[model samples]
Target: MLFTTPTFAEEKAAEKTEQYDPKGPILEHIADSHYWHMFGEHSLPLPVILYTNKGIEVFSSHVFEHGKEEYQGNYKYALIKDKIKPVTEAGEIDTTVRVWDFSITRNVASMWMGMAILLIIFLSVKGKYKTRAGKAPKGLQSFMEPLVLFVRDEVAIPNIGHKYKKYMPLLLTMFFFILISNLLGLIPFFPGGFNLTGNIAVTIVLATITLITVNFSGNKNYWKHIFLPHIPVWLYPIMIPVEIIGIISKPFALMIRLFANITAGHIIVLSLISLIFIFNSLWMSPVSVLFVVFMDTIELLVAFLQAFIFTMLTALFIGMAVEEHHAEAH
Candidate 1:
């Protein structure tokens, strides 16, 4: 009985010790860790791993300091322990259970969101077509019909010509898919949080498609102009190479512009929120949250703006590539 008197207090102390106790400063919750510390010392080559239960982690190829020297290797499951860990000499631990090197990680939650968006748009259009076959559109159709017609009349037809109606499907699909994904990324909650368009790899892939389409769709005149534009004979030597370089540079510029702009927007918003943690004050958090939310609202418009800009530029490039110039006899 005397020994049992102290047992309850000891058990309570043990329970407290076993509970999760963070030993260091808490991290600011950024939208996605993909672009965090993008150019800083701890910048990662891959996106950081986020676990529902375990929190943030990284698979780093870090150098571990041995007693005398350092060695480099993959630290597959390095748990992000504390605010910062000393560059361990024994090599970082690989704690990553699954790797997501691709820009789009197909998690259960993301897949459902993607599927939901797809279904909603498809059903909306299907229902509209069912009710109004040839009659004037109403409701969802009213809003979407103009955008569809605009892309066809203003973008595809004008750029690609009468013989190129077949290509409209791909162009329209690309435009809408990008626009939808960009808009979905603006939502803060569970169903629409993924930054599909902001991923650099996705932008690169889109640019590659545009590059391929432009070159493949080019007529003999297009290639001739690239290799030997109608310049003075003496100037051909200098100008030919420049023209070729320009052709290559166009798509490269598109890739970089989209990637940089999207990534920068996300980073700015994240940095604004991180300001609270930097100051370590509850008072600072409210101001930081307000500013970040305002920027996020602006980003909603930017998402559509970027999609429109990309599509417009793509149409312009196609127009230039497919144009037929008539020259009078000189």
Candidate 2:
């Protein structure tokens, strides 16, 4: 079941006393974990892969029983704060031993699923183009054609100029990946609501790719403007540092903007629903449900808006780097 009611004796008793705490559940929903939580007490356990001082350790996350028990492998390991780490014989966190986790967490799994979805979609769209050549776009091609053209015409050409074709793949990938992931997150079901884009680690990676692309694509004029601006030579020392900071800051803004917007949307929706349990009144459900629907409508628009904004800014930054001066053109 996607959602459950208080049916068990203990759960009913807790409801009677109204000891509900929304913090833990809310945080867990927005954060990545070793297992994919479905609803209620049901979850799909994932593999726990760890590199420790003793060597590699692999086990099912189920062994920890959602962190209620400690698992003894190459060395004792415990799931603390949703992370698997080495623990002492006494069950204390063993700080002496170094551990590196390469496990496929919920977010990683969600990313793979999202990637698979994108592959199926674009591949189908690609095949249709050849088979349906010279014909008006129909079916999926008709659906996706406008979006593809939107990125090219509305976003890329306006920002990156004639060189936009080279970066179309990157910009298209960014837009669809983020858009699909955000849409999936709003679903309150097993395969969805994984919070992939809302995670900081994911945003950092997306932003870093943009940063690398922007810098690598920088033209001779781009570097010249940064290192040898039209400023007085005396101000070079100050402007040089500022120019370098600008390069880093652009991507940093992209990272924070996506992470904060998606995360805040989830938090707000969850917080609104939390009011029902907080007040312990069925009367509040109607009001809460109304607000949730309204916010969800807004979130749907935001899902598309954020993806567009991120792609737009990335193209804008690339445009800044690859643009030529009028003097050079002459």
lDDT of 1 by residue, 1-330 (tens): 000112223433454445421111112121233222222123222223333233444432222110122322232232232112223445554343333332223222343465577669768887989978999888878887887888788777777777457667667766776777766655544345455666666678888888887877777777778776777889888988888887778877887777667656666665665465445456998898788888888887787677767776777677667767576222
Measured with C-alpha atoms, the lDDT of residue 330 in candidate 2 is 15
lDDT of 2 by residue, 189-258 (tens): 7888678889999999999999999999999999998898888899999999999999999999999999
- Tell me the TM-score of each prediction against the true structure: 0.65, 0.94
Off by over 4 Å in 1: 1-116, 161-164, 328-330
In model 1, pairs of residues that clash are 64-89, 65-89, 76-94, 77-93, 77-94, 77-95, 77-96, 78-93
Weakest lDDT window of 10 consecutive positions for candidate 1? 21-30
For each candidate, the alpha-carbon lDDT, in order, equals: 0.56, 0.87
Task: Count clashing residue pairs per candidate.
Answer: 8, 0
